[model samples]
Target: MATQPLIRSDHLFDTVELSKWELEQIMERAAFWEKNWRPGQAPFAGRFAANLFFEPSTRTRFSFEIAEKKLGLHVLNVNMEESSTTKGESLCDTVKTLSALGVEVVTVRHREPEAIQELLTEDTGCKIINAGAGKMAHPTQALLDLYTMKKHFGSLSGLKVAMIGDIKHSRVVRSNCWALGKFGVQVIFSGPESMRDHELEKIASYLPFEEAIREADVVMMLRVQLERHHEQLFVSAGEYFKNYGLSIERFQTMKPDAIIMHPGPVNRNVEISDELVEHPRSKIFAQKTNGVFIRMAVLERALGGVQR
Candidate 1:
């Protein structure tokens, strides 16, 4: 009897589905790829991927571009604002057009996760990667966070990680909770009560203010996006900071080995104090660097490994 191939989800819902061994394999592969980048070694040679970003991105967009190039794939960056979608083309029409163009993977960042799901259901053969989708998921961010934590501590199990600020409107929070929880980390979701998602009870423990930062091994701060305020999700920036922001005084509450992380662009003096952002314990910069390695791993995995 022949063994069946492992069926992985095109949409990375959570990291839990990947076994510990598989996670390690991905990390190891990522580290190796980072150390030894070979020119013209495109596992995706002759293939094309369309970057369909409906929202703004810096790290994710550039990282994917770098990853695809390293793997030898042609990248078609679709500026949604300049596309016919702005002129009233339906999402299905846009996706269909891209699919018809022979793109192999569709990596997208949108305000809605369901939009990606809909595209996947509509397009039978193309692979769909969610770069980010409104407060829903950022799998690559989570992967890089895990890689960063693993590189620092050597493992994620039993680490006390506090996710600070803007839980309600953060895709990073949602993805991290699921990813870190799978590794047996104790995750604390900290923010103003208004920004706390009532639906996150299963994967994280919710806390308010300084209590969440106390003695944690990692304190991950998230930017308080100003757009959320227009939706009435937050009362005011000052009030939000007072309740859950990582002020310098509050930063003193963390364990000595605890590291600070933030997915940039940080709203310094708002979500995190400037001093802490530059402090020795901050791994924000390291996380950004790891973004490239993790993205390389994702592209390699999704594109079927490095080819000669």
Candidate 2:
């Protein structure tokens, strides 16, 4: 990749929009913050952040809430069920209301990728962070995943990552491709043929699942995302696992130092085995743990750190 100019946006919506240096800065800051974070530090003191999640989430939403609280920022968590959207209010009105409430930054996770972007204006007066946006991008998740890999290996260059399962509907995979590529990590895809994204193929290579696994330093499994697909991508769940899932027996074939990873709510015995969730090499839980620190870094950066 060619050297790119510094990113000029305060909002983080897509990994591909950020320069490699910006991503590195966030990862390094997260690592430093994780090691040195202290209570009442208040990097984002006197600022207000709102977490508006239209979609269901476990880690991303809670982690941002925790990060905001830890940073001593005023935090408002909007439950969409109770919001005016239930009364037919538009996303624009909800944001306008938050802006009127003096929010300094907003983090959103909506079903439509473009919904959040459409809310931006010349004088919106608040930073925007993309938590998860459709199947298009989940920039924060990819950032934390990169941070996890960097934490383990100390560098990302020369690493090979095999992304397995439900590639077409996975925002995690989409974001990781752009973020990981910036670090010079080799990324390959594997899944049921019906689940492969044609757009992804223009930039990435496909290999047999087993072959991809054996050669990778990290095997990152994605959720099946059956909720988004109307058609059966595979013949059956058992058959999918049998042909494409990560089993203990197959894990034994991987490099001794290679790691297993999953962005959670894992489908045990489907994309990965149950025991592997707690396996020595599994970084799944660690990814969730790192999410808070990474989010803190993002929040601070978005709000202009402690200086503002």
Candidate 3:
């Protein structure tokens, strides 16, 4: 939490690498850009960037694309299915080819947990950003989550964050826990016992759904990643809604000041009630809006070669 060291990270692969100072710096930049960055302002106008999402995405992909355009960077979105990678061209080779062909930055989301890390070792001249990785990291998402929280509450410290649902397959969970670890925030996980993992047991405690909801300052529901679950932990949507999901009855019991959040693709009536998605206290939509500003800061840092 002291002053950030006089250095910069070109690749945003993990939030654990960021200091509280650095986290605040990015949030500050995001807030400034949201209010002040006007039309026709292009800082990287002539430079080129690419979003190579090997995994499917809607929010993170579009958010980064919008941010790149706002920064004046010419953008290319690689269609993974048609890309030569399907013909055995390696991810690194494709990245190297993009760099050689004039891409200044490559934001990637691969199913491989180490795809971005492997690219870092390859020494491509272009900057790399992690959009999301399989069950691992989604740094920008975490930042925007914090940004949204701070926007509503004015601070991150001492906030009790109950991260509910899909912890086992969530890339967002690690980043949020690691980033919040730098602050005084108390983070806990609540979901089916099958959805809990042992890796973060030291950092966050697991609570029953009811206890987590009652004590939290922020209830962050995650999408139930059905696509990623290999094991048969079959609970019907109605079953999930009744127990683990945030039912309307449960919502009434939360602290009056507590807010609701979901990293999105929200399974309405499953992970959360339909009525609460747009509720006065729900920050779900705000998280999406703040995503643009957060990615603006991240793209700037990646292309700027440092945080200013």
Candidate 4:
């Protein structure tokens, strides 16, 4: 397959604008790139990118580093706490300095979803990719998850996916809904009433815990964020787990071919029981592995125009 032009999602109405065929092409390219990867191809050999992460991440951050190095881009990983932002330098100022340094893209993970939009509208010359921003979006995570699903199921068209837990606070949920909905997958939201988002009314069906699990082809669990938890969200973790958590019995309720997925670091015995997470049907590890390949595709597509 010939390499196509890098198309930024910001120009479109939503990331879902990419057709299913186009998405398949990207994933196929990603698989080929991962299998026959060369170290010094230097797709971004002369370019630079900034990894500005306000929130701590292990999988997403390292995956971006791996992707950048694979494409031979010089990566400047900015530590938010150690930077002048802590000293009252605004995000715009930090972005300006980085842009002036000739960075081609700024991949950021912040607590506010509007941060990425603000950077784009502020006239910073750099292209913006939202690694994760607030509970609004985690495009990369959704992409990786879709890549994994495609690799495993071969197609997404008729798959029944039940996204369980913390829908309101999970950027993963928002992104997955958009991506999966684009592929015509039936996304079912299963969580406490407080975590349910009415906005998802357009794309997903809200289902109760046990009913959603029954006959599901994929059960994607979102982390119950302790840090984001408040007294109003739930009475306690125990109550949350009892209502929405995937227990061993619940695992049996799914179709025999159904798989379980979690964007880790998983809260074992909370959002998902340890027994269910380590079961044969679990795709959690595969999801993590797919992150590298998917990010490789994203980086290459985002900055592959530069010659070595």
Minimum summed lDDT over a 10-residue window in model 1 is located at 1-10
lDDT of 1 by residue, 249-270 (tens): 8887777789999988888778
Q: Write the per-residue lDDT of candidate 4 for residues 1-308, one digit (tens) a residue.
A: 44553444232112454676656656776787777777667666777888999988998999888887887779999989899999998888898899898887778988887767687678777767778878777877888899888878998899999988888788788778778877889889888887777888567888888998995799998898766766578777788788788988888888889999998889888899988777878999888878887776776566543353
For model 4, the superposed segments whose C-alpha errors exceed 4 Å read: 1-22, 39-41, 304-308
For each candidate, what is the lDDT? 0.78, 0.87, 0.88, 0.79
Candidate achieving higher TM-score, 1 or 3: 3
Per-residue C-alpha lDDT of model 2 across residues 1-308, encoded as one tens digit per residue:
22222234378888898899889878767777787778768756777899999899988999999989988899999998999999999887778788888998899999898888886653566788999999989999999999999989989999999999999999999899999999899999998888999899787899999899999999999999988998877877788889988998999999999999998779999999999999999999999999998887788778765653
Residue 177 lDDT (model 4): 79
Q: Give the true-structure RMSD of model 3.
A: 2.6
**lDDT winner:** 3
RMSD of every candidate to native, in Å, equals 3.6, 3.2, 2.6, 2.5
| Root-mean-square deviation of Cα positions for candidate 1 versus the true structure, in angstroms | 3.6
Once superposed on the true structure, which residue ranges of model 2 sit more than 4 Å away at CA?
1-9
**Ranking of all predicted structures according to TM-score, beginning with the best and ending with the worst:** 3, 2, 4, 1
Better of 1 and 2 by lDDT: 2
Per-residue error for 276 in candidate 3, Å, reads 0.6
Mind sharing the TM-score for model 3?
A: 0.95
Best by the TM-score measure: 3
Alpha-carbon shift of residue 149 in model 1 (angstroms): 0.3
> Model 2: which ten-residue window has the lowest total lDDT?
1-10
